[model samples]
Target: MIHNPNNILTAGKPLEEATKVMVMVHGRGGSARDMLSLSTYINDKDFAFVAPEASQHTWYPYSFLQPLQQNEPYLSSALNVLEMLRARLQSDFNLKPSQIYWLGFSQGACLTLEFLARNPMRYGGIFGLSGGLIGPEGTSRDYAGSFEQTPVFLGCSDTDAHIPKGRVLETEAVYQRMGADVTAKLYPGFPHTINEDELKIVNSLISGQ
Candidate 1:
């Protein structure tokens, strides 16, 4: 496994006694610090946020729409980082999978979404902004396991140059099939960026019982 230290940023409370843990992933060409800033908007004094930095500021070399093998070891390594973090959090903090939330933007969003799909579990929640699953146009998505009714929110622009609307729809369908309570919104004419509506939806989903 890669030995890069995660540039984790924390908010709310310390992990030792936090009520919830949010794992935030930044997009390509973005740093952990960029994603960490979102914690200010998602001010939940009882929740702890952790953002992991990708090696060399990129998760993978090629586009997410490329053939599965084209992204190879890098993609696998990225997934391993998340899995390792999850295991560490659970073992060290006594936190259950259901209390861990995953959020990412753009390329990071694609990585997080794909990771959750491949390893379906009852997470605190999932928020993918302007991203979708990885693979070529006709790649099969036969992911197994169930989310156990975990809430997943996906917000993207209908005309996003990086993320296609069809893929967003497909991602929602796959998660729903896995029993996730998914809320997918496609903003019309919006740029490849997160909007207030998306943030509001995420805040509402995370700040609940």
Candidate 2:
């Protein structure tokens, strides 16, 4: 199963002593170690970071915008990995849902946002860099549950070749409707990568500022 705990990489404070836990999902072809490296930029001493390695270094075989069925069980399997990870963090580490955070980029960001949409709850924060919810142009997003004012940040390029601006706005709307305090920023002609401003916003969240 993709949920194997051994496949997860950890960094920063030990979970047992951490007051907050963050799950970092890596992009396509990225490794768990790569994600853990982001903890350096987050720079939160009291937070425990966890990142899962996707089988084959790819969460799915097709673009996230492809029809949901086209990605097959891979997409579902990837989501299950997050589900199990969350469960373990809560049960084993005794972290409440509000103490958990989520962050991802590109394909990984899509997966992370999908998981949050499917299973809504109060979280420390949710950061999606250069990505939007999965599925084609008009997929149904009738996800249920409230975020209880959980802070969420969506940052992407207005001209991102991989992620359309429209989809990012749609994602913001979905989260706002679900009661998340959403912040979306689209940079003009920005490349498909995270920017310094995005990092500053995330850092503010991590610092509780």
Candidate 3:
């Protein structure tokens, strides 16, 4: 049996009754409940929000920049968590990939992007706040498949203590190369936290306003 270490927290409309879905992933040391709180700011009545909890409130134990092997089965397990949620949305709620959005912050952002890279498709949207693709600087990202014009938003401070701006740009380039509609914003001297601008963009994206 594949151990699923995820406890999903949901908000907004039930999946079966909603037209849209948002799979929210939390940062390291953050809970699914905390990720669900963002739905209050998003405030999309037609959307079903699902947040998956990490075991012990952490998806992996090392920095995203560390070697892939170092993260090991924990990283693979985290990816499986997202996959399981996506499958549930498809099987139980009958939602399509294009109706599902991926959103995350910090370490969660890294995991979200990594999973997306491995499985590219036309998603509703993707929000990566203060994060980048996994692995070290010289890691090869020869991911197959295409995003098919999926809109992706990546926001990070130019001097974030945890993320490097270059990595964010690289992620943008990779997604764009895979046919995604990429929008990357670099905030100068901004703190390592989500800003009003990011929230506003997300609300607009999810609301179609």
Q: Cα RMSDs of all predictions? A: 1.3, 1.2, 1.5
- Per-residue C-alpha lDDT of model 3 across residues 148-197, encoded as one tens digit per residue: 98888999999998899999999999999999988899999999999999
In candidate 1, position 152 carries an lDDT of 96
**Model 3 CA deviation exceeding 4 Å by range:** 1-6
Which residue pairs in candidate 2 collide?
none
What is the lDDT for 22 in model 2? 90
Q: List the residue pairs that clash in candidate 1.
A: none
Off by over 4 Å in 2: 2-5
Winner by lDDT: 2
Model 3 deviation from the true structure expressed as Cα RMSD, one decimal place? 1.5
| TM-score, per-candidate, Cα-based | 0.96, 0.97, 0.96
lDDT of 1 by residue, 1-85 (tens): 5525354566667899897899999999998888988888884667888888888889888999998789888898888888888
Q: What is the lDDT of residue 178 in candidate 2?
A: 99
For residue 126, model 2's alpha carbon misses the true position, in angstroms, by: 0.3
Computed on alpha carbons, the lDDT of every model, listed in order, comes to: 0.90, 0.91, 0.90
Higher-ranked by lDDT: 1 or 2: 2
